[model samples]
Target: MPQSINCRVGCPESEAPNTETRAWSESRKMEAMPSRCLFLLFLSTCKLSPEVVAEVQESSDGPGAQEPMRLTDVQAAMEFIAAAEVAVIGFFQDSEVPAVSLIHSVVQNFQDVSFGISTASEVLAHYNITGNTISLFRLVDNKQLDLKGEDFESMDATKLSRFIESNNLRLVTEYNAITAIGLFNSMIPIHLLLIMNKASSEFEENLHRFQEAAKLFPGRILFILVDSGVKQNEKAISFFKLKMAELPALAIYQTLDDKWDTLPITEVLVEQVQNFCDGFLKGKGLRQNNEAKEKTSKVEL
Candidate 1:
């Protein structure tokens, strides 16, 4: 005989697990089942499919958007994490009677939800939820964040490094000379350009736009961002003959041709950058070795 469970919203309809319920006998005693398997069980028991489950979130103005349902399985959790940039997840502790703790977590990926799990949902489906209840809550409204350093939700430059690493761009630092050299010597022969300071809003926006434009060339062109104000990058600055007085400058170096073209990026704009890169690639406009001069600018970081 199989056990019956209540339907959505504690509806009167009761459903049985039927013939497939035997496999879940031990899982029922396990307390916390693997989210992926649990999801499959949920779909089977409810007579639902992925397409039906996916329609739960119809619109941003819909009821589900205001109050997201508790994440019951891996698929729903992954979808929730992808839709919400910020979220609050509830997990049980290791005590005899597990107590739930609601913690705020930034969405890194589907696998790295609130708790310390790093495996993707597919991988996590093979293992149990580690002997505790875990649930994800969506974040739709504005909420105040704890800015104190101790709070896990706070993010710094080190945390932001993971986001940058995901991108194919090489982050050039003082000690990255060798790495830069290796990139310059790649099979495709990289055309290296440096965006001196990315902290400025204008520069960051322009750099993002430039990166979008450069995506068409793929493995051919590469851009490195360097904050030359750091004391350790003195060698890189000196090697490139860069003037600290003009910190926010764009320098393009091609070791293959032994050519260096520098320009002071006083104005950060997409059209201007596209034109410059286009001209450079077409061999139309390049500052002479002596022509790329340094100048003072008011765009402070």
Candidate 2:
């Protein structure tokens, strides 16, 4: 957490956020660098990596619109999933089923989420799926979230969209009502959180560095962004004992142990973030463990 920005740097205390804590959206706040916030918006347009060599699921409508791809072989399925951080595969008995059409519609709606259709019995049995299912694969933590049973039967575009929103865990998941559930319920033990106001000017720089650092940990840690400026996010900031005054900061939360540590940061750099994560892994960043454990009960919810 930051103490105060120097007036010589153009940020004055009078202009800082008050107790009410309205998000600082003014240009003055941007001039002072406290580090930046995370970008991957938790909901931005997720772009597929152009460098991916595997053939992605072609959208049913065609590659012109980038619609869902039809997949039959298990090997092709694996390649489609491997091409992106998050992908959704629809396993149906056949393409004529009503659910398949509904899935195609829903797939078109979420451009950022990858989608594929598989009707082969071999593919279905490979995943132990007996019937129609929509599987969301998040390679970041190797978490496979599924939508099936009654929900899959009555699914519509709106319902399918909600499923993606709630379970779409990207490289750096942002903190919000939707993602909060996914994060807490995640089996991943340690969470690397970035607390900064998205409205801040340095948000892009900080987010880029955070993403780079995330690449180093993969399934080991889940990186989360908690925006200090959003009123709705005050609970998250407070959950980590952070004040909006401290616009940009990073913290590590160990869900298994209910402990956390705040990384003292003057600027958000890939190397610095990497060091913080490495230290935590080596069991060196638990100085505030005792203090943060008390709040673990609330976090458990």
Candidate 3:
């Protein structure tokens, strides 16, 4: 016995066919077709050209240029500094290297800015007493102000005391000679202050880790990481020495902590250490393998 299946030439078996039903079935067949095939069918049906569709596609995916950052206005700068918590002061010294000072700062007037530090702050003394002509800047929101012809003067004791009271900053009790004062005629955007503080905090944490590593490895390893936030010359050098002394290993100094993994130690020095370690490990492995082979041979004999 055999079974036979039959299909009508122009009708679907699922439903009864009429003019509307046949038209709907034809539309569904066309919709189910591949896009390229449908496009060809559409062009054949409408007698339209392919260039129009190609133009539309190009317009949707075209490349565009990004807008540049606009330079901030004075009012924007004032508002930024008024709300800032930390600032870096850049100054030039007798040495070729520029000095950077990080301190708690405040903005007074639109044109006048002030920073407070103990009179004993070596950085302040160097600029004020040493007659160091330094350029000061403030950064916020990736905006920077390059302050030219900046000057620093001692704040009156009464004003200093008032500033301390207003800002709730601690007065140095032990150093009566140290006076706190504000810096005026400076330039820096306020938003950058916050960014600098965040960066400095991260740098300090990485620096602490580097110091710990140095202590563990001693003379066998040396680490060098620089802290850009460290503005005081003596303090920066002292910190460097303290970290180096922890390990009798080679000297390690860091210029800036670039998130810890990639240190900016001299490239040549880093290569040397890596090569040495690799060779030492290889040699040790070879010796172990040789000893194991000797034992096996004796057992076989």
lDDT, candidate 2, 141-167, per-residue tens: 665556677767777777677667656
All candidates: TM-score: 0.37, 0.74, 0.15
| Clash pairs for candidate 1 | none
Ranking by lDDT: 2, 1, 3
Question: Which scores greater on lDDT, model 1 or model 3?
Answer: 1
The lDDT values for all models are: 0.35, 0.63, 0.24
Q: Runs in model 1 with CA error above 4 Å? A: 1-182, 198-203, 285-301
By TM-score: ranked, best first = 2, 1, 3
Model 2 quality (TM-score): 0.74
How far in Å is the alpha carbon of 266 misplaced in model 3?
A: 24
Per-residue C-alpha lDDT of model 3 across residues 245-290, encoded as one tens digit per residue? 2221222211111001111231223344454334432432222211
- For 110-165, candidate 1 gives per-residue lDDT tens digits of 22122222224432342233323322221211111111222223333333223222
